[model samples]
Target: MRILIVHNLLWAHYKSSVFQALQHLVDQQADLSVQVLQIARNERSRAGLETSGGETPPTYTYNYELLFDRYLEETSVRERTRLLLQRARAYRPDVINLTGYYDPAQLLLLIWAKINGIKVVMQNESTAADQQRGGWKERFKRWIFSQCDGFFCFGSQAAKYVIQLGVPPAKVLLRKNAVDNNALRAVYERALPTRIQQQQALGLKPNNFVFVGRLIEAKNLPMLLTSFAEATKRSKNGDTWGIILLGEGDEQTKLIQTIHTLGLTEHVILLPGRPWFRVPEILALSNVLVLPSRSEPWGLVVNEAMACGLPVIVSERCGCAVDLVHHGQNGFVFDPDQATQLTQQLMQFMDSAVDMEQMGKAAKQFIAPYAPEVVAQEMLNGFIKITN
Candidate 1:
């Protein structure tokens, strides 16, 4: 079996990890082969996160082909589309995995694969809750879903979305999203002993929650700030738990002003976005992970945090929250619009009565099966199911 996977970017840390595992798995098989066509090095918003700060070079690498080591935005739309079509035809794959329906190029390639009697698997992360459904878009999505032979989904929410689109339950495989769990755990554990010193050095609170993602309106930064301030007001030990916002975007100016207006400058610290590899160090210093996105397909930061043994506070809208967060067991899931609910959940984590260590351990244990290697096997199983 020869599988050709088309991915958006070479610098996508999560996808790269999964591809590495898939490649490794295929290597041990008798007649199995896997190859990837990385459309670009990075997207425009992600350019900063993709660059290497090291002097020598990247020590860690993915064993695959980078079709274009430049951002897609650097090239004309026509040129990029042409490149994908040309590459897919040349590769002559027995089976192909497309990025998603949103990509016209990949969708066209998926159609081509079907026409040529090659198996096609689609990657879907979108959940019904993440967006406003109904209209021509949902109908178009249903048509696309009907065409694919198999699906690899983010979680239960995503799987359900496809089943609603007329895809049989048996045709959908839920691998969930994953990070390089071992790598994150190693980075976090290595920094664990010096967490106190590191927090002090970084001028951060000893016990704080960490929010790592783009500072956009959809991320609900303003709402998070409002909720945080409310939580502080309700807490007797208000000085103990602070928050660290680690990412940059258009909403930075607004988020900063809101933080100051809310009188949270001393309590809430905002740091410029760092690359994926550097995130685990920040996670080590923090007590919990909070992803309060108003709309999110899947929150991969939740996976990274859980892997580092940090319980997460995720929005119920997030696709990963359904499968990964166990609602007060491993973490808490709150309605993003309800400020009081968020405040209550935050207080639950901040309370000294709560055994955060046990919750973190539960988080790590819950996330073990969502590793890249495990996801790779699920993908292989899906491919086999479709091919047979």
Candidate 2:
């Protein structure tokens, strides 16, 4: 069966789980031919420009900037519709999978696919309660979903939402976000030594906490910093722990100011973000990982941290919290906006080094079922069922 996958290419960074799963399916199913059609708005002009011992060109992926540009500048509704129709005619796919976001591309693609007699499957982000309201946007989304052969949701919450959106319960498929465990294991094995060496170079002691993700309001970095400050006040001399913030964003200057004003200059370290491959090493060197996001559909880094055997503290708003994190078991879950809860959780981890180690072991065990090959097969089976 020929399956044509359509999604914004920029999602490639965190969506490696999807790509890895697709590759796994291709490897296992001889009859399956997969084609990825990325409806990218603009190609990177700087992608292959430099080759010497020169500065590295900035890497671009699916992010706010790219998504904004795609929607605002490069393509319009009519042009995008035309492009999808063109691609569909050429590919002639048995099954067309549409990934959901606020973007119009997926919706347009689904509409065109329906008119052309192709089986369409839409994967969306709505969770139970949010599905009940069918505003104009929701109505349009519902129209697109109703015409599809199947609807795929990220979790039970999203599946419930799809049902609320007026989709038949049998049409909705629950597909959870997954990690590429074998690839993650390989990355962890390779990064462990490098992380230790880097820690020595940076003068960081063992058992420090690390936070990964963009420094945006949604990530709640300011709240985390404030909570860390409060946690430090209750600690002995504030020298017992260190915190590292990874990833860059528009809020860097404001976050820096908060660190300085809070007098946490000595404890907090800001490291520029590295590629996904370098993350396992960073997690291995840390005693714990914290993702204090105000709102997150899914926190992929939580799975990455768990794969590295590091305990995590994630916000309750994260979609992955339900499946990946178990409070007081693998990791703790705190209300994203509640600094006191975050501080309390931090103190709990800091209080006992033995407890931290045990939690880390539990985290690793918790994520063992989400190996890339396993999740990929599940996705492929879903695709097969839809197309057949």
| Top candidate, metric TM-score | 1
RMSD of 2: 4.9
Q: Backbone clashes in each candidate structure, one number apiece?
A: 0, 1
Query: What are the per-model C-alpha RMSD values against the true structure?
Result: 1.7, 4.9
Q: What is the lDDT of residue 116 in candidate 1?
A: 94
Q: Each model's TM-score, in the order given?
A: 0.96, 0.84
Q: Tell me the spans in candidate 1 whose CA falls farther than 4 Å from its real position.
A: 55-63
After superposing candidate 2, which stretches have Cα over 4 Å from the reference? 10-17, 23-31, 41-79, 126-134, 194-197, 236-238
Q: List the residue pairs that clash in candidate 2.
A: 10-62
Lowest lDDT 10-mer window, candidate 1? 54-63
Question: Which window of 10 residues has the lowest lDDT sum in candidate 2?
Answer: 57-66
